[model samples]
Target: MSEYYGTTVEDIFKTQNKRFRAEGSEGVDAVFAYDVQGEGGGRWKLTIKDGACATEKLDSDDFGEYSVKITVDAETFVGVTIGKIDGTEAFTAGKLKVDGQIPLMMELPKLFTKYAPPGKEVTAADILATSESRFQPENAEGLDITVGYNLAGDGGGQWTAVIKDGTCKLEEGLRDNLTVCNIVKAKDFVDLMLGKLDPIVAFGAGRLRLVGDMEIAQRLPKIFSKFKSNASEPVEELIMLKKIISVDMKYSTGPTMGKFLNGLKEKKILANVCPKCGRKQLPPRECCAVCRCDVDEFVEVGPEGIVTYCDIIYYASPDPLTGETRETPYGALFVLLDGCKDREALWHLLKKEDLVDVKRGDRVRPVWVENPTGSVYDIIYFEKVR
Candidate 1:
């Protein structure tokens, strides 16, 4: 038997979990190696302390506290391993194993930079270049469009542009033939492409400049909004058709829900039940929609529940906190807790396989957190009774 004692992947995960729970630190020191079949492979030496990780290309002298060395076939490394890097299958398949403190291993997801598809940046650049190229035509379709100003870098200047017969062109004296149909700073344009800004504010606040017909400038917002919606479409065909563009729109950050999330870290389940219908709400709310009454009474729920339904998410959302999509699918379920006889249930993410086998009427309990916060996110989720 391979006796992985104090320095094993499982131990690393466990220790990291304890450290995170006890001190809220996701720090560790580790060495990891990916053997890329016959071509060439390298190792990564990582040092993590005080919740920060510094990694470097490894050498023979590079030995660390925790280590993972994976050797697989060359074809497997190129096809399977790389694919697993894009998804969470490597961890699930045991192809990617960790050796060291288990708790720190668990924190790896938070520490590591996720891999992103390479083409997005190129697509954004292409969109800008293509638009600029198309707008630099002179005397097209007899449109008397004129560029009133030619200010480069910040796009701050007045320009007089005209439109004729459904065609627009920039006037002479303007360096570029394109009149500003919509004005946006270069930075704001990048932010808009990354889903970090709103179009209305970008234009209204003068962060984006507008020229030519006011009607065209006004219609740009609607057009850009539709363009954004089309860009977000998941269909491969639609994605190829929709060119990526940049804009300047700032997104306001909502209040941090960290404390509420930390409550879940403590393993406490907090929920609100409807007084009239007796429906249990997982994310405890102040008002019950069905009963239209204030749910003043808070109650403790379970660490267990049945997996009602779930969907695998491979795509990333605009929400920044979600980070990168994990390779393993996170299971979400609507669990009916024990002692809540009113058929009321709370929904949350499930962390264990026992939850997968859970059926109706299965006994469940809440894994309560040590410290209680008066928030619904205090309870991570319920686990099934043994």
Candidate 2:
């Protein structure tokens, strides 16, 4: 039969028993007639009484006594039945004509749930097309095997899946040297893939016949993910939280950090030198970590430095100072300043435009603000010294 939007005119009437709601027809007695014109269209009658429904296809022009009659072209008729076109809009646009009781016809939609076109039948071609993507190379490691499928009946085709050394390749038509072969009807294979039929049950019932290696047949599940039906599934609304939390707090920068920020106002990098071991702290520390000696000597490092490491940040977090997120694809750099050595890399931001061109050991200089505040953000960011 010809179809429109994957559904034929006869398909709508054929699904009446499956879509009927007896409870909705309580205390209702009516006959609904449909006169669909054009190719692939016909007249049908629906009688509802005593919480039951009876459907009939009329061969003659007689509609008998219908409480309501609807007339429309085949395309619009199917469109309205499957909810592709709004019934109210179709009537208003003169695409649909109604006669008899208007009040009874208004209750038609409530009598049954909305119609959906039955999903297209899954075929061997469809399942095999997705086999490579669903293959689990980790499970197939160190294994070499050829699996052949000989699906019979409609929508069936021969295919071979070859798995070797952590990779899978699918070939059309069966191979003679298959390690294992599966023989089943195309419908059963589709049902098995959809989890609608059990392999154990089909095999026990002689519906599935296996040839060649038996162990390899059992290992098929481990080599591939479960086939997901392309049919539409119901979706539920997802819960979401939309808010930006702003915290108000402050802490005093002690002597060590205060001195470091003060140096940025003059476009200088400061470091504290440990007297005992001579370890340089880029952001000045009060005491040496290794030597356990109190550090007091301050040294000016570099406004220019070579990058020791760099991170191209794509996902950015909110800036604590501004309470806003930075634009992405920015670079965070760890620079070894001129006067500092031996792992004394200072952490700082890099210019966004220079992220792609900058690399380790590339010299960079801090771009200072016009009017500097004694904050780390005073220097906008370091730019690569091209």
Candidate 3:
């Protein structure tokens, strides 16, 4: 029984279906073929049946036969499996490539259990302690930048990576007149260093703060080596946290909303005109959010409208009520009706051929259901108006 730390694609595939089962929990179905380039790199196919995954080495590497073909180096494959580099980040960085079934490939995380290699807590200090080794001399060959890091907490401290002409030196203390600063928590910084946290997501979410040149901040990840955690601490007495927040809620919809619902039964879209601002609101509300006055007058808006924005959802959980997974990449449309005033928009699904080539300001007409009950689904979905 060998340990899991010596990460190899072949070694990992051999031990599956025993300790853990991959239940394609995201309702994805595909056969994934891996095409690696490097020493001992070879072709392998992973069949994801419903939610379960099983792997086999392919004798002939014909990528066109598989549902998806992923291309990467041998190290990246090992790195991805061991959590040193995230697949999405790798793809974004152009270190990894996927030939087909991209959405299915995105569901790869469900096919493998998170295996934490056995090791002691490699602190953030231990990682940054050898920061010089992580820096790339080539990237910063003639670059001069001072980056200050402040990781606050019990196990946190300030450190700086000062680079000059391609050489980066790590100091445990603060450095003055820095080019940029990144302030993060100790645990989060360690996670980010180990590829457990995506820098892109972190920066997007404001977890990783940048004070100065963002371009210099962007260059740091590429120049540095990825930190690998030796062992992941197991959860002992880990409470399965849950809380049920039940709210018994109902909306009266007032006279304005009530009239709007009535209009819906007759297959009409209505809006309320505000007295103060003269603003029109669709799916009429009692009072306008913009104007503090009552919206007394009602008028019909769009039987045909323009799409303001649309999202083509490729993957998401199955519908709770229907227990049905939709054939994905469906368009969720936000439409501004023909007669609507200002920026108020209604939500609807864009169906049929309308799903293709949908863009902003594309004209759409509601497809009403036959003899509809006053449900919102009465207009089942909207379609492109030719």
Candidate 4:
């Protein structure tokens, strides 16, 4: 039996349970019958219950009413499952035939995660050979450097990339006086080249060791194009629209929040003190959540505080205030200000430059604007106090 893209018809069915999305299967009760033809093909019944799925192989005796029944060749079934062939195109070409409910069959892809074949292991030699081919001469103008790779462990060997005069050449073994030498395991080197491992994370984790000029190491990615896998298939590009929809709106801040925003103009981080329990509300709420008592007295907390929690946001959507998208990788920090008690942490942004070094218990001070605004935007963000 032949396989399509390293995936057999049986392989696709066997891994269906692992790929099944329980969340998507909620309230979905249906049976899907697959009558795959050709070698390595067989009849199978996939039954989905409330947040669960089960697959049973059928013999010549088994035949039951199903919500949807699909008939296709083994190779086409495997190809479509792994995204190598388009299912809609196959159906139009009469290679794939469907019976029973068409809408249920159309929504089948959402019921389970996309099937991914176990890819062929990429070797270091395969990556090193493409150095010259993947080099971008346009980005390498006036560049002269030797990047040494002292890869160790299985399938490991020394190699050097001599980049000079708008060209790059891969050479076997390392040479003396290298600009930057990278010491890492061969498996990690392969993952790093494939972008499976982030270079910053690997460096911080000590999995990747770099010596000599650090600046050139950062520029290497720009000097070379990304490496492509030999066994990978082309993916369908998704259509995306960049549009900003703006709506003008305003709301009354009320007495509690009004004082809070007004205090920002005086460089104050105000929190309302509860008259009963003494628990402070970071944004100066009208009532204390614990004691249910009115909070009228407000006190200043901190322009500087210690971070209780930090998150480096990589995929930030457009800001609601400005309707403009921020740059990639910004920090969202929850800070425990000096005068604030437990559960009274103020939520704010941290400086982008400080994200790499910021951790819990780290001291941070707010970086305010020249002219204070009567809003939370008075301070741009917080930065680590050196």
* TM-score between candidate 3 and the true structure: 0.54
**Which candidate gets the maximum TM-score versus the true structure?**
3
Best by lDDT: 4
Provide the lDDT at 304 for model 2: 90
Better of 1 and 4 by TM-score: 4
- The better candidate by TM-score, 3 or 4, is 3
Tens digit of per-residue lDDT, candidate 2, span 1-386: 77888889899999876687887887789999999988889999999988888889999769989998999999999888877889878987889988776557656766876677877766778998999999999888888999999999998889999998888999999999899999999889988888889999999999999999888889899899999878665557555674667787698888998999999888777899999888899898889989888999999999799999999975455665554666666899999999888799998899988977888899999999988888899988999998
**What would the per-residue lDDT of candidate 4 be over residues 1-386, giving only the tens digit for each residue?**
66877878888888889989988877788999999999889999999988888998898736587888899999889888877899878987889988766557645866998877876788998998999999999987888999999999999999999999988999999999999999999999999998889999999999999998999988889888899888654468666675767677799999999999999999889999989998889988999888988899999989789999999865455666564666657899999999886899999999988988999999999999999989898989999999
Tens-digit per-residue lDDT, 292-383, candidate 1: 88776666665455544444432223334433344343455666654444446666655556534656555555655566564464555556
Backbone clashes for every candidate come to 50, 0, 5, 0
Global lDDT scores for all candidate models: 0.47, 0.86, 0.77, 0.87
Error of 1 at 146 (Å): 48
For model 2, the superposed segments whose C-alpha errors exceed 4 Å read 14-29, 47-56, 59-66, 110-126, 132-145, 150-157, 162-169, 179-192, 196-225, 231-386
Candidate number with the higher TM-score (2 or 3): 3
RMSD (Å) per prediction: 19.2, 21.8, 16.8, 24.6
The 10-residue segment with the lowest total lDDT in model 2: 314-323
- Tens digits of per-residue lDDT for model 3, 170-226: 888778888988898888888888778998898789887888888988787777877
Q: Candidate 1 has what TM-score?
A: 0.30
